[model samples]
Target: MKKNYVVMDGNTAAAYSAYAFTEVAAIYPITPSSPMAEKVDEWSAKGKKNLFGSTVDVIQMQSEAGAAGTCHGSLQAGALTTTFTSSQGLMLMIPAMYAMGGQFLPSVMHIASRVVTSNHHSIFGDHTDFMTCRMTGYAMLMSSCPQEAMDLAAVAHLSAISGRYAFMHCFDGFRTSHEMQRIEALDYEDLRGLVDQEALQAFRRQSLNPEHPTNRGNNVNPDIYFQCKEGANVKANSLPDTVQHYMDEINKLTGRDYKLFNYYGAPDAEEVIVVMCSASETVKETVDYLNAQGRKVGMVQIHLYRPFSVSHFAAAIPATCKRIAVLDRNKETGSVGEPVYLDVVTALNQAGRGDIRVVGGRYGLSSKDTTPGQIVAVYDNLEKDEPKNNFTIGINDDVTFTSLDYKEIELPHPGQISCKLWGLGGDGTVGANKNAISTIGFVGGKYAQAYFSYDTMKSGGLTQSHLRFGDEPIRSTYLVSSADFVACHAPTYVSKYDLTEDLKEGGTFLLNCPWT
Candidate 1:
């Protein structure tokens, strides 16, 4: 099958990848994640045939919990089932997720992972929601951006079908989920060829059949309950290899190497940042810039998190990495450190890396800005003799006094053209930006990216659109702080939001208004 490229957001990418293989999708609409389910529903409505030569059965549930319950039922009845959710919607699915995992039902839950109503019920990007589901026995796969969101999402489905553990494939909520990017897609035939036919057939044979019915989710006493629960450890421990095997197979097909942890930087980097999600892309750009300047710095991007292999993580780190900063997108207060930080500490401890100093910091809660400058601050902290035990970035934390000082540095993206659009919800601003990106990316042969942000409720709510395209693959994940073009489609928003706050010198500003 020939490869094709399209300009699309993370949600659309996930939908397309899953739609190719899925037999059933239990859907519930939630901000930043609704588009994924909507895409599946629309396609199913249009009678889109999956590789199985049948249109996927999309069932819209009353709630997220209903979606999860239905997903479990579908998987039990021998169907490849999935769902898309985030934040509170995800929390509602926990009980069913446990049942599905406990029963060893293979399913995939595509999450545009978001902050779960912390400071406020923010419908924004973060790992706080994903962090809470770490112990659910699901194979948690993290994708840094839309492309990986598409690639690893397929990996998740493949892994689930082959392995006993279900999968939760996640990325930054609005940053990646709503952000559009041009990417070379995996051909459906190529992806289909990678699925283990024997494993899938065996799974189908094991499904619930009236001809050979069996009782699951039964009440068990302490007698054999512990043994039955601990019995899954063998399969659970084997997930790392299972995930890596598919990643390797994908690399062979695509010529792109993907592993549990991918390292990018100078060969002998003394300082490094270990992170995941879209921020890894931003950090990679920082690493590339710093490496050219003779700085021995690098980054380790974590893709497989649940069954994190300490050996693989240790192997990925440069032997010369003396100081490392683990950036946590979600803050787990009252713990030793944030989720990933603790995991990194445990991994390093297991690998006997006592010589390397590892510190943790928090950033990007509820979609707060996490720029390259903030990442540079993380590296600077690594250079310190005694860096702040736990620091914050992209904010002034005067109360805790744990904020890192960083000089705002300009990102050097070649042939980059950034644009900003301001409009109200349902005003077609987001739609227009999507079309603009598609035109530039598919026709102009330029790499393109776009992201939209707006509150769910609010009359005449303001929506911010960030669009960028260039000759090279665009990596900056955060919103456009500075743009070459700015447009305001809603005249009333002029007094409410700063439209040209980040416009560059000689930048074009277009305002839509009545000629009074």
Candidate 2:
């Protein structure tokens, strides 16, 4: 079977999948997530057809709140609706999210998960934005990279339609959202083939039209409101199976295995790390490196976060797992452990796996790179008789002494060529690297990955481009700590930054400077 491979970023991949299933898109521009809506709008303008055989009606709203309202109204009128947002933009949609979910509308919101501005504002990626919505009656699904963003996005839509639940399909902002990679493209035919048409028509028949004449959203007293809220227990309980069914369909089409909880590394691993979002990619890479070195380690990557299935969590863990580290990407202040950690503990206790020692660690808050080095520290921590609980990684927590000691280590990728470039923000370095990755993947017939890191400053901020390509697939999700080639596009960076600190010995160095 031949595949149609395309070079694209997570945003484009999400938009491509969303466009196939969406009939109406209510959009509000937000960093990282904006590209998804922009792509959908662009495609609709070009007269692209969805599975419904018509162009999607794209509406640009004044704010995320308005966009969500528009999405809710569209879904009520029997249109399959979608919206793209992140950060505070997602927060503004909470009121509407509850309404849609309660009505059992199958609206898929594509979220490029970003840092929810706490004391300070940041436009970077993190899980705080979406994790805050865990109680909002939506089934959450996360993708670690561009390919999963494309594939799982379809599962989110199909499951939402079939299960009659709202779905938030989230990918790490900037990390997965902007990183360019080559992936198998899913055509509209694939989505149409997988979608349950009868379920979709059933949804349409329940629309708020004169022909339907249904009553909804009536003000209720405490007597029935409590019972009404609890009535969704059956639907919520069945969501895991619904999501898995679609995931299996996608596996059949793409030949890539996906589960609610996907495990990687040794089957009889003694130590395990459970994590979600883009950080899972880094953990998986580290697990492979450790297992090759004869260490019994493994990782469990979460897909469907909401409607937390304890059975699936227990089934994913190996019997030999003596210690488990649950890593959360977001920090919940004043809480004993972050969301994922708490869930893992609950799942273990509920599943009668309380014998396994479970430790919780926080990493990648506000998009901090969760490197192989940090992952190693987690495994090392697990080795201790009394491992550190509620610990931190990837940063020096001098005040609290909760950070694990980690040495910088790079995972080996055979035949892979790594390159790093430093430039000023708005200097077009990121654009150039994106184009380069596309060329390498498409023209050069190589698998490539590119990630751009920069500060919150709109312009004149420091920026770095990490690029890698090889004959084989690239799974290195963290920043390139060791590069075969290093380049400094801004002359000032040569003096301020340690440009060649990680450059490989006998490697090429390119300097862009005025003075010879």
The prediction achieving the highest lDDT against the true structure is 2
For residues 83-165, what per-residue lDDT tens digits would candidate 2 score against the true structure?
A: 99999999999999999988889999999999998988888888999999998899999899999999999999999999989
User: Where's the lowest-lDDT run of ten residues in candidate 2?
Assistant: 186-195
Candidate 2, 244: how far from true, in Å? 0.3
Those runs of model 1 whose alpha carbons end farther than 4 Å from true positions after fitting are 456-459, 493-498
TM-scores, all models, native as reference: 0.97, 0.98
Candidate 1 lDDT, 1-516, residue by residue in tens: 356888878989999999987999999898879999999989999988888889999899899999999999899899999899999999999999888877778889999988898667777788988898987888899998888988898899999988967999999898889888998788887887888889899889888999999887789999999999999989888899999999998788777789999999998999988999999999999998888888899999999998888989999999988988999998887987898888898889999997889999999988987888988888888888898878999999889798999888888876799998988888888888889899999999999998887766633577888899989889988879889999999888788877788899999999999957
Q: Please, what's the RMSD in Å of model 2?
A: 1.1
